[model samples]
Target: MLDEGFTYGGLLMGLAALVLWIRLALRAFPSVETMIARYQDEFVVPEARSHGELGRIAACATAMALTFSAIGYAIPD
Candidate 1:
């Protein structure tokens, strides 16, 4: 009962996180290209390279969501 609810909740949370991170990564893609072109000759700081970080986060979120959903479904009702 309570455990089932928690399992579903975690699954849903993971899915939501995956969606948000993917959205952010997509939005940042264009800007990332532009930033690279604009700063081709300059030394861009690590803090400014957020698009790469967002991509990594999105990938992790996707993996997390997949694992969470798998575990949730594998749990016996």
Candidate 2:
């Protein structure tokens, strides 16, 4: 039971953190394109890539996190 609790707590914390991060990001960047344009050279990593590697990384992280959370929830304790 303690293990289950820990897993659930971790999942909750991760989800909460993700939500807070996304909220902060939204607040900081009301317009993604405008923000990108403002700090294109400085902020954009993996230089010269139009699609933007950072964006791809975020997408991959989101997918992996969701998949792990689902597995955590589905696995028997």
Candidate 3:
């Protein structure tokens, strides 16, 4: 079962999703920081707050995806 295409394909897909979520989550943080730095003149920037919210959402999604990846890896077909 482990050598079969289904298992390999599923693993590959899980890995790809995990990587994408992690990358998005990481990028959101820096982008938020940059926006805040670039717009320091403004007392409050809605865009920065939105980006921060996006970062939190992405981080949560990444954590969930990572947990699923770990579970998938731990359990064998």
Candidate 4:
């Protein structure tokens, strides 16, 4: 049960990260600025429009790492 759940979860997360990386490499990632502006009615974009491509990538990687670590902490062995 442990390997079945945790390994599969890790695999799924890896695939998601791979897809995001492909989008970044192909310049297919959506406009961060436009998204922030579009959804201004709901909430706030913490980084604003000033976080450029590299910044966005860094943020994504950091976020993914954090979330991935969360899965580990959530499912104890």
Which candidate comes out best when scored by TM-score? 1
Which scores greater on TM-score, model 1 or model 4? 1
Instruction: State, as a TM-score between 0 and 1, how close model 4 is to the true structure.
Output: 0.39
TM-score (C-alpha, index-matched) for candidate 2: 0.41
- lDDT of each residue in 1-77, candidate 4, tens digit only: 66445555655666766666665565544567757776786554444334367556755765665566567657757
Per-residue alpha-carbon lDDT of candidate 1 for residues 21-42, written as tens digits (9 for 90 to 100): 7688567555575688566877
lDDT tens digits, residue span 1-77, model 2: 65566456657656765775575465544366655766765554432333355455556656656665676677787
> Which of the two candidates, 3 or 4, achieves a greater lDDT against the reference?
4
Instruction: Tell me how far the alpha carbon of residue 20 in candidate 2 is from the true structure, in angstroms, after superposition.
Output: 11
Q: State each model's C-alpha RMSD to the native.
A: 5.4, 7.8, 5.8, 11.3
For 1-77, candidate 3 gives per-residue lDDT tens digits of 43344445555665765766676666556556657766787554434434555556656655655665566566676
Provide TM-scores for the models: 0.49, 0.41, 0.40, 0.39
TM-score of 3: 0.40
List lDDT for all candidates, in order.
Answer: 0.67, 0.59, 0.59, 0.60
> What are the per-model numbers of colliding residue pairs?
0, 0, 0, 0
List the pairs of residues colliding in candidate 4: none
- Please estimate how well model 1 matches the true structure, expressed as its whole-model Cα lDDT: 0.67
Model 4: residue 41 alpha-carbon error in angstroms = 40
Error of 1 at 76 (Å): 1.1
Higher-scoring candidate on TM-score, 2 or 4? 2
